[model samples]
Target: MEFLNHFRNGLVEGEDRDCFEKFLSPHVSMLYKSAIRMCGNPNDAQDLVQETLFCALKSFHQINDPEKSKYWMFSILRNLFLKDIEKTKKRAEIEFDSVCDKLTDRKHPEGDFLRAEVKSNLQEVLGKLDERLKIALVQFYFEGLSYKEISESLNIPIGTVMSRIARAKVYLKRELLRSESMRLEISKYIGDEE
Candidate 1:
């Protein structure tokens, strides 16, 4: 508790610290919940919330309306979350590309064939989707982010995220069905030739 107080004191001073504590401290739980939803993991959520509090402390003087402080903190959290998402995405893409390149350079015919088939199928399905739908589906399904989290991250309404996920699923099912049929037809043709 002593350490916490010392840390708090380091964050702000004078009347500003009093005002900041009165307005912002009450909403710590709400911010933690939001951080959890946005981060999708407890450790990351804790880190995010800590960073958000530090930032809020640094800029507490800029908040003019005490009633709007909640919204202001939310906006700050959202920005931090978005920036983290971008950094993660960039790092993942680079790592993914590097792994793909390494895997492609190795010559294992069966493994290569299986990977190619799966990759082609996924690419075909994803390629047919609109960019917005693709991103929405990836964030919700692949990343396991909740609808509210997706809405906050994408800066869209929750209803819009719902509709996009529905539409993307429909498109994926249709494309997969079509691909399956084509593959079956080709298999039959090759069997007949054999």
Candidate 2:
């Protein structure tokens, strides 16, 4: 606690980089452990700590309360961890949508074989739809594009995109029931709507 107070005081007094580094080194392991739990990955935890340290150094002058210094660092680490999760989620969604598009457009015999193996487990109703309907479904739900964007990209009216998405859901309901395992997986992905 006395160490923390001195570290806080140094930050408040605009301590030299070397002095700050001495103080920071002692707290590195503690901060890294906290960050690991927050981020759920070792690499991300290390990054979060580095970022938190950078932020703390940059805004050290604003921390007036030495006693609250620990909380301040934790707050910065938490926010960074959450932001990292959000970025990962967005990237995963984009990659999934890209893969879905490629899967839907594949024309090779091996592609068909692979699709047959895995796609059969989906609510087969999706498989039965025309390529256009499949594309519309994947674009709106899988890719999360707005109706306006979908319309412009598909070269169709916005109203058409809306109706197509709605109809796609109905078709999905009918087809997915054919395979219970696929139905459960699909439900996990789609959820109970937005």
Pick the lDDT winner.
Answer: 1
For model 2, give the 10-residue run with minimal summed lDDT: 90-99
**18-115, model 1: which lDDT tens digit per residue?**
86588777766666666654554566767777788778877987877777677677667767876886676521110122223333423555546544
Candidate 2 has a TM-score of 0.36
Worst 10 residues of 1 by lDDT: 90-99
lDDT by residue (1-194, candidate 2, tens digit) is 33334445545443646535654556666667555434435766676787887787778778766444555665566567557656765111111323333444366555555445335434234435554565566656654657875675555788998898888778766666456654544454466552
Q: Which stretches of candidate 2 lie above 4 Å from their native place?
A: 1-19, 90-194
Look at candidate 1 and give me any clashing residue pairs: none
Task: Compute the lDDT for candidate 1.
Answer: 0.62
Q: Which pairs in model 2 have colliding backbones?
A: 123-175, 123-176, 124-175, 125-175
Candidate 1: residue 103 lDDT (0-100): 32
